[model samples]
Target: MTGRSDNRPTIVITGASSGIGQATAEAFARLGARLVLAARGAEALEQVAAHCRTLGGDAIAVPTDVTDAQAVRRLADRALAFGRTIDVWVSNVGIGAVGRFQDTPIESHEQVIRANLIGHLNDAHAVMPVFLRQRFGTFINMISLGGFAATPFATSYSASKYGLRGFAEALRAEVADQPDIHVCDVYPAFIDTPGIRHGANYTGRKLSAPPPVYDARKVAAAIVDLARAPRDTTVVGSVAQFVRLGHFVAPGLSGRVMARFIRSSLDRAERVPISDGNLFAPPRDAGGIDGGLRSPKQRALVGLAAVAGLALAAVLLRSKPAYGRTGHAERGPALPPPTPRLEHSR
Candidate 1:
């Protein structure tokens, strides 16, 4: 089915209670896409669903933990009940642990891997069968630039992102013969999302995404486009391209830069305590899409930067004629080699 038709496609989103997921839900809702929203917080999911309905979109909230394969299957079943078929599944659930590796608990690291990596796997497993049966579907994987660069204090975050990139690559290959079935990977740079506030903090300093934070709506808009016209990969921030290039050109120096920032810049920021923020439990309240950290002036500046970044990517893609087996742009001659991984918009 063509995704351009208004109010036709049924979409499902994990981590839909807040941040990028919440923003994405609203975006698709505005397009008249039927939505199935899932997250650990039922109250928060219902609230988002209500907002979608107010926007004149049909939406159903199903509280789900992506870490649980069974729960994800049930989520798929419930979503199917809504519209009889699922057109898109956005695996957007992610959690972070920020601290020196030794200082962080093993449990915290494991949880990050579970939520960010294995959780996404579960999403694919539950949804791919349906896609294969229907012979057409879009699977959106929400990854970040950390998938390429090694984060110093947030080692677990880096590992999960890197793993996610690999996971998407493998899944793409497995579905190579199915032209209509699409697996889309999205890499967004630092975004002003409630995820930063909800992530676990152990650095003895409040954890925050470094500057040049893009709006969550930017990434959400990309996801909506993927639903309408499937593309293998999309990069949101310009910095993500730079990081991929830097890390490839000088791995040692790139890592050193990250380490220095974590040690000096982040360590010097506001002091905080060791606590697992919403890793194991639902947050007390469902935070909204915007993180509310940046002022209006900062947002305007970032918006311009985001536009410039998109323009640069467009020019580069046009110049470079490289296309991978999946018919998506691949890194090669004509420009600096591009990597498959990138940073988070969230």
Candidate 2:
């Protein structure tokens, strides 16, 4: 922890062109951390780097597709070249596709798995050697609540996140004794970023959950906090925490409840063409290639929904602690047996 205060620690972040990644870059830059920002979009990466520079931190933009192992390796090389010691490497690249499992194309599933799961693996493989050599470094993987539970219409995404979560947990234990090296996983719920609207394709043309989403800035702050303290895992929002708790307390029940909600939402949602002759890209590219959940209205709605869900969860958990678990208490009333719920989409 005792590194140069003036120079700060150098950090490499993937998916740095926008959303949580961009916000994280800015946050670290504000703290004087030298940055090597990587993302697929060169133009957008440059913009983020410029903003980081304006914030009084040195940054180099490396256009990278995390799905490409070679490109990810180059990112690690660039970070090492920038600073002999890379203090942190954050894998934040991810994409999502939402639709009924049968309707969702195989290509969509493959792409998301590559971006969300294999991408993180590529990043870790690229940076682990550097951390091993230095005997000191941190790996931060941007995971999602979807990793913990499945949601309807997002089967591919849920699978990817779940895989990543398992990878992170196993890796943590594998390197537990290495005090000099740290691996942390962060789980955040719907974030108010253009990525939501642009990155995900809703089969029903609507979001399963209501709004009141978290701001990227909030997540960024938490990332910075993680950099300083290095916890094994952290949930970035109340909804995220609730989901985690739900998974632990009543695994099947949570999934079933979430499935019902998702089913209802999709049932009532409007279905529209997801493409305009563009097979690869999602509609509403409204936020540009790298932008996240672009619309202000959508952002507000998501945020409100997140807040409401958290509030309701809190009330339910507090008023009926037994609802999450199935057991007979000696003194209190016996709780009903928990039923499995449909997995939530992250």
Candidate 3:
């Protein structure tokens, strides 16, 4: 355990007002972790902290803008003041912009990079010193499968994820000598979160993570698990593994497949106006952990099943032989008809 035996462990989570961060905070709270929640929405952050408290955690809300380095530093100071020490710092603030790269405004792209990549960097900068002083701490970076695969409409999101993945790797390498100071990355596939509703949707269509979307709690579980058993990387959903494998085996084909999938999903979705949600300001609503967009019963295995079905169909199509109008096999001899038999009445 990261916390002291006498008291609850201290955990600081950014983007705790809603979505995956809120879910993660709740998960840790169940384990009796003292939480310091940070987000732009002060009211929402406080609400989440209250919920955590209800879950048996001692929590304090610290409204902060992670893109501002000084603000993040102040956040760290606030957390230390609240818990007296920090055991884990979760850099979970991330946003997405979905549209054709050229069609999307350059400013929107820059904003994604700033919030998703630079904000995480700021979190590390502010907390690493504290970790060094204490000689033990864990920083969890919430990266998505996009970190490994190039997404078409979400160009900036892909860039930020890729950059964040690299950042975690480098940070882990730098802290390799410190056995207790850990840098961890969580890569989840499409998750059910308000992020779909809050993201900047320039695709001229409604934005939603394609199913089978995993629950935010699924990712949260992995984050909470890190406090006990810290691993360099943890992938939450099976789809993440599949995407990584596909990308590694056939980068060009995988990219094209992803592009086609995005295009189809967007084109089929209902239209929605463009908005830079929570990018320049606080979120309009205190959206809960689950986005209500995905079913809790959904599993990443559904995707695997679909792929397996398609592969079976392809194999069957390739192996089947052409038949004439008589419907006999073209590649082999026809079989003889079965003899008829009569049965006696009992």
TM-score for candidate 3, please give it. Answer: 0.85
Q: Tell me how far the alpha carbon of residue 131 in candidate 3 is from the true structure, in angstroms, after superposition.
A: 0.5
* lDDT tens digits by residue: candidate 1, 99-121: 88999999999999999999999
Per-residue lDDT value at 303 in model 1: 63
Predictions in order: lDDT? 0.81, 0.73, 0.80
User: Clash pairs of candidate 1?
Assistant: 144-342, 144-343, 144-344, 145-342, 145-343, 145-344, 188-344, 188-345
Clashing pairs in model 3?
Answer: none
Return the TM-score for each candidate structure.
Answer: 0.87, 0.80, 0.85
lDDT of 3 at 267: 75
Candidate 2 lDDT, 198-222, residue by residue in tens? 5556474755344446667778776
In terms of lDDT, which candidate is strongest?
1
Query: In model 1, where is the ten-residue run with the lowest total lDDT?
Result: 332-341
Question: Against the true structure, what is every candidate's RMSD?
Answer: 7.0, 10.4, 15.7
How far off is residue 52 in model 1, in Å?
Answer: 0.3
**Ranked candidates, highest lDDT first:** 1, 3, 2
Between 1 and 2, whose TM-score is larger?
1
Model 1: how large is the Cα RMSD against the reference? 7.0
Compared to the true structure, candidate 2 yields what TM-score? Answer: 0.80
